[model samples]
Target: MSYNKGWRYIAFLSGFVGLLGVTLYPIAISPMIDASEYKKIQKEARKNIRQEDIQPGNMKVWSDPFGRKKPDSE
Candidate 1:
């Protein structure tokens, strides 16, 4: 079947190859390649502290300090 010139059969073929790589190559062939660059990012992420990692601020200075109800008369 002939496709319009603008619709790329080459692109479709390349996409099929990529899909085959992801599905078949990983299973039948050798393991997928991994770069060492992500190791640096993993190290940085491990250094960052979570919210509860440090002690919370003093509650006395909080916005709604006492949690008091507003007066009835508007």
Candidate 2:
């Protein structure tokens, strides 16, 4: 009985540690590891984008597909 209890305790502790590591990795470790790489990739992506491409000039913000006509004054 004592041997079994000891093994059970070991298993429980191992599982608890594993769960803690998994839960904390994304919240803590991943940011530290990927922060620089992520910023570099974002910068490269932004370099290809232009202000004209992001502008919404002459484009309707929203349109009703149900054929509802908006007032001309609006």
Q: Which candidate ranks first by lDDT, i.e. highest?
A: 2
Please give the lDDT score at residue 51 for candidate 2: 57
**For model 1, how does the per-residue alpha-carbon lDDT over 1-69 read when each residue is reduced to its tens digit?**
877355487788888899988898656564335534567777788787653545466333336767898
Candidate 2 segments exceeding 4 Å error: 1-4, 37-74
Residues 3-70, model 2: lDDT tens digits: 54777989988999999999999999998987987898889989978756576976555567698876
What are the TM-scores, per candidate, against the unseen true structure? 0.32, 0.44
Which 10 successive residues of model 1 have the least lDDT summed? 53-62
lDDT of 1 at 50: 51
Q: lDDT for every model?
A: 0.66, 0.83
Q: How accurate is candidate 2 locally (lDDT)?
A: 0.83
